[model samples]
Target: MGDEKKRKMLQRIEELMSYGEPTPTIEPSLLKYLDEAALRGILETLERRREKLIEDEKEWLAQFRKEES
Candidate 1:
């Protein structure tokens, strides 16, 4: 995916991760149009990237605490 589109997708994913949206918000029609492999790959990639971002955030907070102390 292109950088701009990928960034947009990540933004949406971040929002969805919160207690804001309903599960399985994807519509049936969109699913029908999507290629199964592509969709699965995108989802998996997003999931991994999100995990890494969370880990990085935690590390940053820990470092900040040490500096404060």
Candidate 2:
């Protein structure tokens, strides 16, 4: 893909991330450009990061409650 196309794709990915909970469904045509492995890797990475964020937020909240007490 050309630089312009890559930039546009990255922008779209960022837009998807902004949706927060319940990730938006990617269009089939968009995935058609990516291989299965690449798509899977991207999803797995996103899931892992989301899980980590949830865990971190839980820990922070617990500590916050302790400090309040």
Candidate 3:
């Protein structure tokens, strides 16, 4: 795949993070792994990519559908 296609593939993973999803609940004992700021920043980046993927996918699908018809 070309660079654009590679970017598009990555967008699929990003799409999942953009939506509000329940975070993994950690037990009080494992709280050492918690990093709210890091998590938030990652989610912010994902949210942006997710939005773009959604738009691109819609166009991609529409074109496919039209071709099939």
Candidate 4:
């Protein structure tokens, strides 16, 4: 994927992640138009984002427990 396309996809993914809920299925037309490379890039980026969110959540919970104690 080109840098600009990748950047746009990353921005969209981040926006979805900010919702803190599972992402809904993307529009069919959007998926239909994407080449395999773009799809793979999106999936890879999303997985990284998911991992970061999981780590952030764990840290937040640990801090909360410490404060409670």
Cα RMSD to native, each candidate?
A: 9.3, 8.5, 13.0, 8.0
What is the TM-score of candidate 1? 0.50
> Per-residue lDDT of 1-69 in model 4, one digit per residue for the tens?
555665566556555555665664454446446765876677688888788988999998887674543
Instruction: Give the per-residue lDDT digits (tens) of candidate 3, residues 1-69.
Output: 344443443343344643555553333332234354544555577778877988998988887664543
State the C-alpha lDDT per candidate. 0.59, 0.61, 0.53, 0.65
Where's the lowest-lDDT run of ten residues in candidate 4? Answer: 23-32
Give lDDT tens digits, candidate 1, residues 1-69.
Answer: 454555455445545454265564544344445454565566677778778988999998887674543
Give the candidate number with the greatest lDDT. 4
Model 2: per-residue lDDT, tens digit, 1-69? 454654455445544465455555565456447754565567567767777888999988887674543
lDDT of 3 at 49: 80
Candidate with top TM-score is: 4
Mark the regions of model 1 whose C-alpha exceeds 4 Å error after superposition.
1-28, 67-69
By the lDDT metric, which is better: model 1 or model 3? 1
How does candidate 3 fare on TM-score? Answer: 0.42
| Poorest 10 consecutive residues by lDDT, candidate 2 | 7-16
Kindly indicate the candidate among 2 and 4 with the higher TM-score. Answer: 4
Sorting all predicted structures by lDDT, with the top scorer first, yields 4, 2, 1, 3
